[model samples]
Target: MEIERKLLKRSSLERLVDMMRSDGNMIYAPQKKETQVVFDTIETFADMTEDYIVSNQSPKFVAFPKIEKILDFSISQEGIRQEGTQLAAFPPVVVLGCRPCDADGFDSLTAIFNWDYKDELYNERLKRTTLISISCAQKDDYCFCTSVKGHPGSTRGSDILLTRFDGGDYLAEIVTEKGKALTEKYAALFEADPGIEKDKFLAEVKPRFEVEGLVQKCMGMFEHPVWIEQSLRCIGCGACAYVCPTCACFDIQDEAAVSKGERIRCWDSCGFGLFTIHTSGHNPREVQSQRWRQRVLHKFSYMPERLGVIGCVGCGRCSRACPVDMNLSEHLINIAEV
Candidate 1:
């Protein structure tokens, strides 16, 4: 619980990256891919994108991949053999330049995975990864972290947090024991903080809505026309859930050869028509409008009631990725007003 502050020079970041890699850690940083910025496995600091507000994808994939192997199986002459998931095999990771919203979203993911049954794979990766989140200096209109009780410089799930200073240096907040270990191990890279504050350069995001009773309001709106109006243009591509920081729906499948096979879990979306189809061929959420209502209610109502945490972190990637421009903030604000 000891909060340590330090100063990091811009030039020293490359050295830090080198230090982490030399320590047998995998580095995940934001990289430029055409017009989008993505968090990718990086070997050097030069591979990352600078001055980007948010990544096209969340760092959630670092721990919970879009597709992951759950079990490997083989059939023999006598019987069947299966190899289960191994916790010791997960590698140590250092996530650099993670935004505050994405870091906070990790808490929601952790809550879900560890809720009823402990997911050893995800927990192992979570334990092994150290987040070095950078405060947002720039944001677009789509960004609304404040609406979800998050801030640009908040340290919810990050181990270490970095904020840009006036002189191109970074003000580092060692938020956790892991972060403290990292700074102490690489003590040469960070200098004692000279009382410089982080607020000067932090991006200011206004709250989009009064979220107090919105979840309750959503229940009343199950039959409301807003769902139809809002989701009419939805193409059901599931792009929003894919880019979301806290969407955790997934489908398990067994991919098999003649004698060998693997059980894998892949990302799924409630936005899709097939998400809740019964085995008897009855779909509760048969239409796009009902499916849209499920997304809103689950995030705002069910998650909060069940997990004691709001699901959305308000990174705004869903709005950015949606082809129909289904702005979540606008829709939520409308719901709040209703």
Candidate 2:
């Protein structure tokens, strides 16, 4: 679809931030923290690094945190009673300078959270946030976003997309109603640039993503020896699952000092041997290879087959976060080519 395009000069950085901040929105962007690029609240557009590389942690942390507190309860003498439970409203948020993969991952996440359970907390958080994807001018060797129907510079689930053209000006495309509302609110910061058409800038986007029957092919190799041989040296740790953009498995626990406590949710991983251990120590998936196979299957086949779309965003964080060097991209490409 041809979207309405606008122009924002390099000087408009402060203006954009001011506009968003005026509405009590939290603006988060990639900030330089020593050697790594981390996402944090940015008070100004100067904090936005246009040439910033991939963030050490995918922006998923902003949506579903590693650990979260859900509800709290209190008990005295009479009976159990509900205590302070209502959370503060999530003010408007703008995730600025997000990549296409990060944006798509969040969109895919909405499905499961809103499935049968209907998580109102997560839904509320999402409604209050706006995703603004900034086009990537470069692609590293480890990037495989294109393989899963994603691209380095493409915009899929963003409310607004910014494409940097020649000179210091950017071509902006309003992708969703949130983007329109934001643009309308900050109309003075923008000017219609006729030098470039919407498609022209998008034409230059090159993501080496190859989405064939890669996931399905991985499905075919569920019990194959490759898993056993490749994963034999792997230690049963949850680092891979912990760093993956699409890994949503979690365990909820309640903590109570006396008769009442708070309900908490935290991340979980299949790599842990105790993940499937029954009360009687009956572990169906006892080996690391079996655990690893489950990871591949859940990401490649199970999620897509059930959700009608790809599960993984191909962020490469799993490979980067692996302790034993269990690179996911190599395994995926190996199965995909076969």
Candidate 3:
């Protein structure tokens, strides 16, 4: 379907937030948390911070939580009973003010969750969630969204994409049916199209390296020495994976008591030393170099071959969050040159 264009004022945006809240939708927006900006549930539009280039954390947590209880089980003399988390009870959610790269990361996650088996929990949460992304008017050195086929104002995964003009008004592009419905519901808040050019208002993110070339180089460099050289300073803190939007590695654990137990799924990272440890005390990726290889290959080589989508959106949160200054874009550029 063709996208519908409209104009939305800053005042109208505030009212729209209120209207969504009144309709029982949970709104997650960027808020100033101490020294960094993060996405947190907001009661009103005023809670959102407009001064940040990007949120410290991606809004993926709204659908894929860091820690989630999948099921609970009780033991008895006769038998054992288990109950799974109810997906139908999930609340409708709106993730507002996300960057286009952040929104595009969801595609990688969706491919992983539904690769061979369907994940009802993830699917349900995603179905109920609507993405309202705000275009980036400025960027920092760490941003490389364009290198991964993403733009500062790309509407790949957004329901509604809002680009702010110089005058504080927004050029709203209703990209999906979900966005159309939202606009229709709050028709009064939106005005006719002002025919604004969104490109001029968006941040200019130049491509660092060709993603296809990077993928090809990664596919044949499993045993290359570059992994060891690039990861020499890594401390295996897993900060990169945790802050990344597309790294979906996880660990499942069973918490048990005398009569009951719960199964939980928590975020894990390939960078962690214990991620590949076996009960026999053997680890496939015992060294940081091997782990680093896994991370790069998973994103650039393996995922694209299997899932038909790259496992990175070049959001650069990983680079910014790395304690040892491991810049992913620079590393990939080097590999592409190799």
Candidate 4:
């Protein structure tokens, strides 16, 4: 699709932020929290932090929260009652400053949520949200979006993409109907595209490895020792999954006092030993090695085959957050070579 392009001055960008909030849209952007940069709710443009290469966590939490109430149940003398979150009650939101990897990961998450069963809450939230991604200007050893067919300026799951110019200006690539509508509504804030080149300012990320035939290679390595040797240092911490943008595994729990309770849905990780445990005291992924295998296979093999989309977005947050310095790129390269 041909995207609409526009030029926005640094000061005008702040006006856009004000306009979205004045129109009653919830804005989520990067903010400086202590030492780390994180995606958080912002009240004004002044609250936005512009010094981060990437956020501590992905913007997925805006649509798929870490903790969500699935339904509330009540018991009375007459009968039992249950109520669920209403789709109509959801508020509109805008995710700003999302990286390309983070925004593109939404496609993988959407496929999983709308797969066999439609998750009403996730779908509802997605329908009401607009993603505005910023082209990456900085990348590190941990970043490798190119290997996954993604780029620093990708617009896969973004409504709009903003690329910085030399003079504190931004080039806006309106990629979707939602983006066009927002620009049309706030026409005064945007200027006609002056045909300025955007590639000069965008980050250049080298591909880590080729994904072609990688999934097929993984199929034969199910019982390979690489899985065990590579994952031996894993501490069973769910930090990698938590920081991942496409990981959608979750667990449901019933919280009760006696008569009143709520069924809650919380994030889960395949790296955890008990994630696939059965009630009969048997676990499918009994060791860290097996659990690690599931994580890699699901991202590189299962999701791509089933949904036609790669689950990993190459954000590198997992590698950054890993306590044992488990580099994802290294593991994948090893597997591909084997």
List pairs with backbone clashes in candidate 1.
Answer: none
On residues 45-87, what C-alpha lDDT tens digit does candidate 1 reach at each position?
A: 8998876889999999888989889999999897899998787
Q: What's the CA error at residue 281 for candidate 3, in Å?
A: 1.1
Q: Estimate each model's TM-score.
A: 0.97, 0.90, 0.98, 0.98
Off by over 4 Å in 3: none
Q: Write the per-residue lDDT of candidate 2 for residues 159-259, one digit (tens) a residue.
A: 88887777767777778888888888888887886467544444333344355566557657776887787788789788877767677888888888977
Per residue, candidate 4 scores C-alpha lDDT tens digits across 1-338 of: 68988998889889999989999999999999998889988988899987888899898988899988888999999899999867788899999999999999999999999888998799989889999899998998899899998999998889999998888789999999988888899999989995888888888999978886787787677889999999999999999999999999999999999999999999999988889889998998899999999999999988888988898988999999999999998899989987
lDDT of each: 0.90, 0.76, 0.92, 0.91
Q: Which pairs of residues clash in candidate 2, taking residues 3 or more apart in a chain or in different chains?
A: 146-209, 146-210, 147-209, 147-210
Q: What's model 3's overall lDDT?
A: 0.92
Looking at candidate 2, the ten consecutive residues that score lowest on lDDT are: 200-209
Which candidate do you rate higher for TM-score, 1 or 2? 1
Error of 3 at 332 (Å): 0.6
Sorting all predicted structures by TM-score, with the top scorer first, yields 4, 3, 1, 2
* Pairs in clash, predicted candidate 3: none
How many steric clashes between backbone atoms does each model show? 0, 4, 0, 0
